[model samples]
Target: MTTNAAMQGKAMSVEEEKIQGGVQSLEVGLTVLDALTAHNAPMMLKELSEVLSMHPAKVHRYVVSLIRKGYAQQLTDGRYSLGERAHAFGVNALKRTDMLELSQRYIQDIQQHLNCSIHVSKWFADGAVVVQSLESNHVFNIITRVGSRMPLLKSATGRLHACFQPEHIIRPLLEKEWESSAKPEQYPANWEDFLELKAKILSQGYASVTGDMMAGINAISIPVFNFTQQLDHVITCIGTEDQLPEGQMQQAIDYVLGVQRQIDALFHPAAAI
Candidate 1:
């Protein structure tokens, strides 16, 4: 007694349901990966379950599958972190021809020249992320790791981005972060001071932070511009006060600038003017 129109409509509805059902498992798996990524560190099973608001048993099942697929790994302590496959994917992402592969040699050259920790950050929708890093041979251990998010109003790279990027693109993000802080007074004393700092960074073509994130540690950040003169990536040099001596500041700055010039020559040759 089913009419032809009713049969066609039922067929279409069934097809839509099937399509949605097909992706449900994949979507759940990705949700697990995303939660781990946001943590940026290894987490225990119960802790991860709490964060995801899922039952421990369910999370365990997903984690086991992820481990089998090499997307996640279980540490000796039974904590879970992103495994080899995930890191390999990140490395591959960084090595894309337009960015890391082209600049890697320069990064190495700068590291060898300064003998300090070097960080390369790329702008993301949320903020800057450390995509690559090189550790120096010195005993000083700078603990920054890849996938770490940069502070918008605090870190040297964050301030550099604020200076080079358009106000429309950067202001809202800054305001949101400011509002999130339980202590708003901790930010620049006033808006004028913040603007002034941005101006200074632009004029100097770099920004520096000393003992802000970590006591006795210091860092200098320089911007890289793409062919369109837009912000591309930021290079940050980090070390203790002794490692980055006051006398060597200019030399390091000059070397970093030279490297930026070389990158611009290749990536944005016509716009390098």
Candidate 2:
């Protein structure tokens, strides 16, 4: 890890919420944000509290803080709304993605050496997946257009980390994902199969598809970890079988793993910071 990254990544934690003395301020804030994001509009304190199952008094404290911090604001009617600060934080957080930027160098190297398409991904709140970045030898391709929100069960990139990453690491998220909007048919199989795939992916620590999601697209994906090296995002190499020749598939996997190690180095606190 670099000296600067160590200082920045210090802010990263596995708690999944803002640290507090048994009080999850971040969770409460997200609950409110979730309601707003779901409704696609501002919501009153009563509506937000009802949706979040939190008391109005407590919700008001959070709403007030959010307003002060600029993450949220009050409307003319006194309802809560996402403030411009929320978008600013998003854009700022995005700017810190040395991982995505660094990964592209590796992506280009892999594509040129392996002669295929390669990409990186980061998990979004739900349904949609962010491509983060992508590189390809082919002038035009169908795999993971940049900024595209990939379906959880539909894309190889989605399944790569979604299923393969450990439940201790992936569960709260997968559950939160389903809770947000679950239509089992999205995976194109029975519920039982989804469970089975979860097991298969976890056991294998990776997922590959000869033909799934979009037809004629072949992709192999491996999960990437955060500072503690827990599975969080994924790095995938995509290519048509026609473009892949002989042992190139295995080579691509080996290459991606190597790149993952390099990417991982940047996240480790000791070296990164």
Of the candidates shown, which would achieve the greatest lDDT relative to the real structure?
1
For each candidate, what is the lDDT?
A: 0.81, 0.67
TM-score: which candidate is best?
Answer: 1
TM-score of each prediction: 0.58, 0.49
Global fold similarity of model 2 (TM-score)? 0.49
lDDT of 1 by residue, 1-273 (tens): 999999999999999999877877678888899889889789999999999999999999999999999999999998999988988887676445476667778888888988899999988887889998889999866867999998877788787877766778877778776777655556453457679888788887888887665677778888776544677788999888788765667777887888878877876656667
Global lDDT for candidate 1?
0.81
**134 Cα displacement, candidate 1 (Å):** 1.3
- After superposition, the stretches of candidate 1 with alpha carbons farther than 4 Å from their true spots are 1-97, 180-187, 268-273
